[model samples]
Target: MSPQPHEKRQTLAHRLLEVRLQGRAAVLKGHHNTNYVLRIGLPLAVVLGVMPFVRFKYRVPLKTVEVVPRIWRSEVDVLAVVCRHLREVPRGFAVQGDRSLHRYRRGIVLSEQNPHGPVDENMLREFAAFFVRTAKVPVKELPAPPRDWPVDGESAKFLHWLIEFTERRVHLPNRERFGDLFDQVGIPADAMAAFKERHLSLVSRRFVLLHTDVHRANVVVRRKGITVIDWELAIYGDPLHDLATHIVRMGYSPTERRQMVDLWERAMQAADLGPLTAGLHDDLDTYVDFEYAQSVYPDVMRAALGLPTEAGDEHFRVAAERVWSAMDRARGPLELKSVKDVDQIMEALRKWHSMDAVSAETTVV
Candidate 1:
């Protein structure tokens, strides 16, 4: 008698879990293929052929789950491996670590089954507060951000690098990429050039630890507290970039988004962190706009996956258009003077949202 294919896969999964978990006491609690609950475990060691980095250890009670439709189950499994590794390291935010974890041989297939729904406004605010608190911690004390230390006049440069890096096909084709929906909308090349030119310098501000992918799905609300997972994209960068990414991905309404921004401002102020000054806020708005503009790139996934290009293009076009219309309504004339004016920033946000609305309508029909 021999093990069947399903049994073999399960055996491999269990073996991988054991190797990854080392001697840690963990229970496989859920029926999902890649789900487990690990309570009170020491960090697993990563044994390289050469020197072994001291794995950061944390005893936090953790539950890990990864769900991928049949089409993307393989890719999801790879992602789950990375997630499991991160869970072993203490001080690991959602995005931080070596580039090896960033690479995957396959692309994700996103459908209604895999769609990330809009985050609730209240949850958005709470996560915003949590992110701000986590980000403000001095770098030396925790995991360093994924890039060079922040130098003045390099904010835009950093952002450009990130956008380019994210767009690169080597890591993941823009279309198959999870977050490249903005590139699909038909923004004129000139509009994109102007948008980038106007705000490339925004990246030069103070850098902080950022989750990089702070969307609702990455955050799991548990009875203990909000536990943010997935740090493959975590980096040391502009805090607002993190906020903009989360807000855009969450797909919140303009009014709800605005309220979340207000909550972010108040939380920062109350913490004596800093004012949400006008320039900074506008810069965040611009980041959101650029992200919206690039949303269409994800349409490329259709061709990559051997699906009908026209249908995929149409789907991406609609998504990009909606986000662009929202941006149009959310943004205003950029009056970014300093980094503390909350009102001016909110105006810009209003315009961005308006633009996103137009794009959204175009996407539908």
Candidate 2:
């Protein structure tokens, strides 16, 4: 007979307690995708709580179950399953295929969680390789898109609306608020307008299965391998969106970021996909720009989550400054000298110390 609700609850409680008690110094750490480090006597089992956007949990008995989930809403489940699958493979062969699989799973999960966090560069490269490989797999043999999904037009419209809604509330400051900085840094009104237009245009492209969010926090590094957690935003859209999200969230230096692009190009080549085509590059660029813009959301969300107002304000100011700096760099050479000249035009945004100083030193031509 099936267990009663009360019995099931009791069983769950007992299992969790047992795992906690038996586990040694295991702490749950993750802002988005919660996880538990389980020490089963000798072997360590990292039980990940996947799905940052939804509520669900799973405990796999073995390390080689199916990676894809039975339900559509359970991307975390699929990720956990994939991690377990990679872990079970023997060492030699596993080193190659399993490593790629593990990184791919972890990258997807991390992308779903907070984007700004520490990441293992090597693992990310491996995952990038795997992403290109999997995407190139014959479409006919791939799994079907989710049921009743909106077409690209509807999806693009929905995302555009979200961007607009978020933009309207730009006045609000949060832990990572940066809109104010954007306005101060001379990001021309035209540039912002063009960015929005480009985003809208790109969203209408052919959709592929994409992990809409790729960030650092959702990925976990263990002795065995990396594990990816969340998958709620998995959708049909441009694959480049996933790559761009990963690149932006990794927070690599400009040089490192360029290297990542090169790595992606290499992976594409290895997968027998043609050289980095212009169309593909443009798609990737569009996604990267959008990801950079959306990066402000985290600080905003952090403030919403009750971080101190001062801290949130600082974050917002800094992010805005960074955006402005990037925009200025994109424009022509810098030209401003003396504090008087700088202060007369752009307010002395204390948060942007370097830019402010530079502006003060240069004379506008």
Candidate 3:
């Protein structure tokens, strides 16, 4: 039997992505996916041969916590919805098996140009415009939300669901492996509960499509405008959540963050999305708190997991500082009575590394 068209596309994509291929191919590695980029030329009959440059992305298998529903099962559905409405988003042609191909956007990542730098007024306005455009997309056009997704426009329920997801998926799943380390670093099991209780006053706002992960690295700056890539983490939720994540992940200074919020409010108002910004000033911090609270688990766990097998004291020190910083930021939200000192965190990392090494040796034998 002949291979299916989808199968052929997958095969060709894999072939073009091979490291041994003789061409100008670049492998872009990200936390969740590994992308292989190359330009090809051929007859119109063949699949994707006419494109200037194509990116073949395969999801990397890793033990990760699920904070939001990834359209990984069929990214094409969401991509269709987003690209149809927003030209700045890269269009995904197809998702076959584990591989998905996208038209490569030729530009420098915003992070490369300005890492954790302040955005100028013009760029800030553009960023706000993108958010406004995304927020205006009708939910009917989006793929069905996950079964546990909160009802549309239910901001309070959405926040509660997020807390539940963090507790159920992020914390419980990894408790067996990292529970002790979590305790050593001052993260108690009741942390999420306390956070949820403190943040119950979230003002209701109409939910909308949100690019949940809008960090600098995910944004490509072209001469025409900014193209936001990596829509895998996109979700339909309170718009403020997206803004909060962007502010935190973009590493904006205090003044820049305030300016960005003002710009976002103005843009939304101009687009007649005033309702979406209702109680934004009052509730934005709650969303920011949630971002901090939920991130601590992954930040600490990834730090520990990222240590090299033969890591020395310096590695442990770096990992400890990373974990400590996450804890410090989360203290207000999680109501942590005290944060673990750097030396304490370093000792805990050293122990975890030793145990991890022993486990690896056992499996090897």
Candidate 4:
């Protein structure tokens, strides 16, 4: 039988250790998981993308098992396009170990000399060119989504599918525990109001394959151009949603974020695919909210695992600040109800420590 939940977490943790013990790799922590980089290696530099699985109260529910394989398959599909169509990005070499489920892309790891932040003008322009090229790739040329994968890629239906996916993942798995979080924080029980389809109009838009999780760590600087890594979260959806996730997830300052936005608009228009830009100004916020909503469960549960029981309140305070910031950014756009202001969230976090800790278990790496 497969290992139990806690055992799975330990196994993943051990897998990380195994790579680290290899003595040639440097540990680079991504937003959600920790990846190992051996940039200097020859034919391929392996990035073992293992991290703590989420700590839901139960096993990954049968309902959610579909997300696992579907996402993996999507990653495989999107990577094929990047390899075949986009020279501006990295080539995802197939690996033997990845045949099991979770795998990593092996390539040159961009270092401080070549980094993901500090916005490069040329790099941004090239990224725009890459978008034009990606859009031009014929539909038949791109790989298809798996059988059970949601087929709707239009703005409206895709948004609905994404919102529902986040909701079920966040609320259903650990209903009472997550509810207690809301109750303690003073968020309305109906925190999903923002996700319901309404005034949003997505006409003039068609879906394109998106690097949905475009953050600094996942993107690496290269001599030829910029190379994006970590394809597991890749999805087929509104291209603006890709931009939305990129801006929020990447720690760009307000000024930098604005700069990137201006760059994207100019680039897409220049590429002659300007119609995809429709509804971007008004609807991008909704996608940002969805990202935050989708992220809270994993963030909270991960924070719980490292409470520093013997260390002190300092760690707790730090984690609370992070979680509060998540709620702060997300709640307004999410129309998250019953949220107990920041002070309340801090208080709830305090009470939470008195109870048993959130366990480490099978997670999405």
Candidate 5:
């Protein structure tokens, strides 16, 4: 038999308490993701990791690479592989664990989160230089690229992944809802096709191991400088994807986004990696489109859960506004036939609130 609901809460609370045992301050709920992160020191925090592969554990913690991979980790810990080679990490952390614990995995120690906001262009440029240089750091020999990513041309491989991910992963699971989302936004469902037609040539230009998940939240601001964290999503794809992900996820204003691209290009050029920044003139939008497009599902799911109730009208409005942004950006890829205004989208979210409680009721554009 399974544990009672309260029993489950107790278990989670117990785990959180264990996570906070070393903290100098309160254990704070992480800004995003399920992990409960604790402020261990002035510029230090440790993320209690959720298991990576298994999806439905009621958002419960699962086994994860809590240590610096170099200190201790499995072969698949590519993040650690990079940590082993790179120096400009968030801060140094060694693995800490004990035998008595049941569920408290060693935490992913990081410098404090990037003051919970976007980094400036100068910082972004510094990060770009550090990023590519780290990529250039010659490992004794780069291990075989991910199996999903064969040792093939970067452009073709990621294009294949993009379409496959959207169609199979995004469209398949939430077909009706995703289709409705597209219809509501007046976008073509064949957005993936558009991505290929437009951006394919650009990604083909360069091949470098990329810290694909570099965004503001993952970047921690320190007194000295910024430290990039969250290396798990790192992929060996077009370097532009890194820039695209950073632009979108950091919530960089349009001006800053453009500056980010320019700064990145200049940084790469200075490093003599000019070819790496190629195709930004036209192809960057393709990757940005893919980033926004792919995010529709996850964004909706988050909005559904976090939207406010009757007493929380203001919060709900904020959540609705965010959903509106996601839908608006993803309109084309989602293949909407009609554009739903923000008010309509807000109402839809209110209607969907009941469904949010049903953890397994998964479907969204």
Candidate 6:
């Protein structure tokens, strides 16, 4: 009898491991995974029934999140649905242990290609097209959402859930460890509550698949077109949330941002997805504001945690600048009383660094 699907996965996984152990795999560092790329040729190539030189990406998950859900768990299931309908997405292969494998597309990443500022009109339209395609994916086909995920078209409730997730899972859990730093850096503990109060109402629109993290780094510019990778953060929710995240993460200039929004609306209308574009003008900014507001916690925490053990003035300066930038973007949305200047932020970092070092030493002893 032919080997079952799981058996085939195991066999392919074993072969990939042998290659990785032999040091034939090229390594790339990612925030959540250590990716090893291998050009699987010969008998293994036949296993996928493709060409001899098909490359594959092998990912080993890092213990990056304390309480946040393992992204790959949702990512694998989401990809199964997306790959069935879209060809630009990478085909998820299998998972073994905490590691997984998928087809690796060869091309320059959009970030590397553009490097800075806005993309051209052609690229922008392609982005809109991709978004429309993603929106058309039937909700029933998606894997079950998390407990208490807002029902479809409940935009206000959806935004509330996201804020609660950030506050509850991302912020509150780390408050003990990072609270002092947050206070010193001018971020009030009540920032989220204030945001919730200010943006209490949002216009309802149909929920669709949202690639909540569609930055330039996650997009590969291929000969055929641009292929968006990294489905790890995909979620079902307000479509505007996807656009808002894309706009902020892509760092589009004011004119380009406006143009992109127009393109998106036009594309959605043409595709007969007008219901998804409901309240495009009135409520889009709310989603954009929410993106900025939620990002501050992670950005500040990461900057502080990124400091080297023996970090110097230069290292502190970099971390402080990162924190300052995140806060500057979020200040309005979060309704902060004040934002710390770089020097003030640096001082806060210094204090946190000292405390962290002491904590580490105590734990070791």
On TM-score, the candidate that comes out on top is 6
lDDT per residue for candidate 1 within 1-55, as digits (tens), equals 9976645544443444355556554342212223223322222222111123333
The TM-score between candidate 1 and the true structure equals: 0.51
Query: TM-score for model 5?
Result: 0.67
TM-score for candidate 3, please give it.
0.92
Which stretches in model 1 have alpha-carbon errors above 4 Å?
Answer: 1-121, 142-153, 166-195, 275-278, 302-365
Off by over 4 Å in 6: 1-8, 11-15, 41-52, 66-72
Give per-candidate clash totals. 74, 20, 0, 14, 10, 0
Q: In angstroms, how far off is 359's CA in candidate 5?
A: 9.0
For residue 13, model 2's alpha carbon misses the true position, in angstroms, by 7.0
Per-residue lDDT over 208-252 for candidate 5, one digit per residue giving the tens place of the 0 to 100 score: 666766765555555666556544445565677777777777777
Compared with the true structure, all predictions reach lDDT values of 0.45, 0.44, 0.81, 0.57, 0.55, 0.84
Tens digits of lDDT, candidate 3, 63-115: 45554546336666688988988987877755345556677787899889988
For residues 292-317, write the lDDT of model 4, one tens digit per residue: 76666656655654566653667767
Relative to the unseen true structure, what is the C-alpha lDDT of residue 225 in candidate 1, on a scale of 0 to 100? Answer: 46
Name the 10 consecutive residues with the lowest summed lDDT in model 5.
Answer: 65-74
The local lDDT score (0 to 100) that residue 279 gets in candidate 5 is 66
Which parts of model 5 have CA positions greater than 4 angstroms off? 1-25, 31-76, 90-121, 139-143, 175-190, 197-200, 308-316, 331-338, 355-365
Q: Give residue 153's lDDT in candidate 3 (0 to 100).
A: 83
The lDDT of model 6 is: 0.84
Which candidate number would show the highest lDDT if scored against the true structure? 6
Q: What is candidate 4's TM-score against the reference?
A: 0.72
TM-score of each: 0.51, 0.51, 0.92, 0.72, 0.67, 0.93
- Candidate 2 local lDDT, 1-365, one digit each (tens): 99776445445444543554563533444443233333232211222222222211322222321211222344433344333334421111111111101122222344444355454568657667556644553443334555644454354553454355345433233213344444444433333345567566543444445555455665655455554444544555456666776776667667667777777777766766643333666666655665555443443233222323244445445544544444333442122221122332124244444443445568463
Ranking by lDDT: 6, 3, 4, 5, 1, 2
